[model samples]
Target chain A: GAGVSQTPSNKVTEKGKYVELRCDPISGHTALYWYRQSLGQGPEFLIYFQGTGAADDSGLPNDRFFAVRPEGSVSTLKIQRTERGDSAVYLCASSLNRDTGELFFGEGSRLTVL
Target chain B: AQSVTQLDSQVPVFEEAPVELRCNYSSSVSVYLFWYVQYPNQGLQLLLKYLSGSTLVKGINGFEAEFNKSQTSFHLRKPSVHISDTAEYFCAVSDMSGGGNKLTFGTGTQLKVEL
Candidate 1:
């Protein structure tokens, strides 16, 4: 794709179930990021990956929230034992590198917990 | 840790009127500032950023922002807004350390441009 792409534009899951959202970043982008946006709120950072390594994951809300970017080009955010409060629009973004400061964001995956 | 604050939750303006969205940040270290816009049912798009050099930065769609270090502010402005400019505006900040990768965003300010 010419820009960052996210899969499952909308996801509906039951409480206590698990879900995984995927992100495909722009080609050659070495930095990938994950964020969550609640209704009427701005996106909150969850994690950031530099190549195949997660350079920052401090923003992850809890142990249940995990993300992986094994190939550095594609990433996945996995949530275990999801709660109703965990529902939000999961956003993915990528940049040429952290130094550039401009990030290209995906359309986002809206996760609804029922 | 860096944080951003957007003072106004909503701003209603008539078409062709000027609009300003205020943003403030708190951080001990140097930081980079950015403004992003979100149209209805669309993903966020970068409006402008303040990385270095001149404090006043121009962006797409006739939008601009001024970075003020003393006030720790980056406010977006447009001299004349059109109805099409109605959208949500977000302010973000990132610390200079570690390439300032992670961004802290404000709640957002909704700009309602009416006829």
Candidate 2:
């Protein structure tokens, strides 16, 4: 079975530019989540989606970060104004549902804001 | 809010030697505990979890963790570690208050198994 898949294994962009990272969850998965991992740190939660609606977006760093899962399958994390501080590995994860608690994670999209 | 802390930033052990990675969490309500491992250039993988029942929870790749509610700790331990066990280990906590599935992760402990 296919695990969570993230596009553009690596991306480098200029500061103050806009960027979009995509995630493809496992087939039949109803829950999705986004996280960011900085150097020497663990993955930090960013947002969570249950079906097509976002259940929690409190982890998002600021207003510049937003995510959407309109069809309940694929999700997109958009950064309005990328900053050098935004450089990190963006990770996506999914579960059968929120209750199971076990989340399958994707290889991740490494974003480098220069 | 809940938070996790992995006491050691790195742990180096010889092959076939015992090792333990300490983790502590703070939360006002009931919470679930988990341990995740990440090999170089790979995604995080679940090693074990402690939701309820007994304190000792066994997980993949010959690992186990003891959940001590009183001490607010869930430390991972392995009797004998292999060179393959070299990786970063993260401890996370999720409580009932928040979207039960949202996990708060620790900085991570790098396990370097030396031969």
Candidate 3:
């Protein structure tokens, strides 16, 4: 697809389970970002990757949340021991570079931790 | 750190009526401002942006916004609206401190355009 692609548009998991969300950015885009949107709230930044290196991961809530962009193309977000509070829509976005303020976002993956 | 505020949680207007959505921001350094629209079950799409140049920026779908540096505000406006314009509008900001393009978004305002 020409836009960012996210897998498992909807996922339902029980608390304490592990989950992994994948994001495939547009080809040639060097900057990828991950955000979480909770009910009635705006999307909050999670992590950002620039060319295979995580430029910033400060937005991550805790150690249980981790992301990796091994090849600078596809990235994955991992959640360990998911809790009910983890339920939200995970959004992935990509930009040509880090400097450009514009970001192309995917439809997002809806995660429901019961 | 940067943050955005959208005072109105929702705006209800009739068809063909003018509408305005307010936005405010707080940041230590200069920043870039943007307005994004999100339809049901879809990701956000850029409606307009204020990078540098002009303060009154025009965007797609007949939407426009004015950047007020002194007030730290970027209010979106449209001369008239249609039913299709009903959607969630988000205001975002990204600081220009060379800290990557990480946007801080407001809670979003749902625009309900009625007939």
- What is the Cα-based TM-score of model 2? 0.98
Predicted candidate 1 versus true structure: per-residue lDDT over A1-105, tens digit per residue: 598899999999999999999999999999999999999899999999999999999889999999999977899999999999998999999998688678889
TM-score of each: 0.97, 0.98, 0.98
Model 1 over residues B40-96: C-alpha lDDT tens digits? 888888999999999999999999999998888999999999999999999999888
Q: Best candidate, lDDT-wise?
A: 3
DockQ of candidates 1 onward, in order?
0.76, 0.73, 0.71
lDDT of 1: 0.93
**Global lDDT for candidate 2?**
0.93
The 10-residue segment of model 3 chain B with minimum total lDDT is B94-103
lDDT of each model, Cα atoms only? 0.93, 0.93, 0.94
Q: What DockQ was computed for model 3?
A: 0.71
The order by descending lDDT is: 3, 2, 1
Q: What C-alpha RMSD does candidate 3 show over the true interface residues after superposing them?
A: 1.3
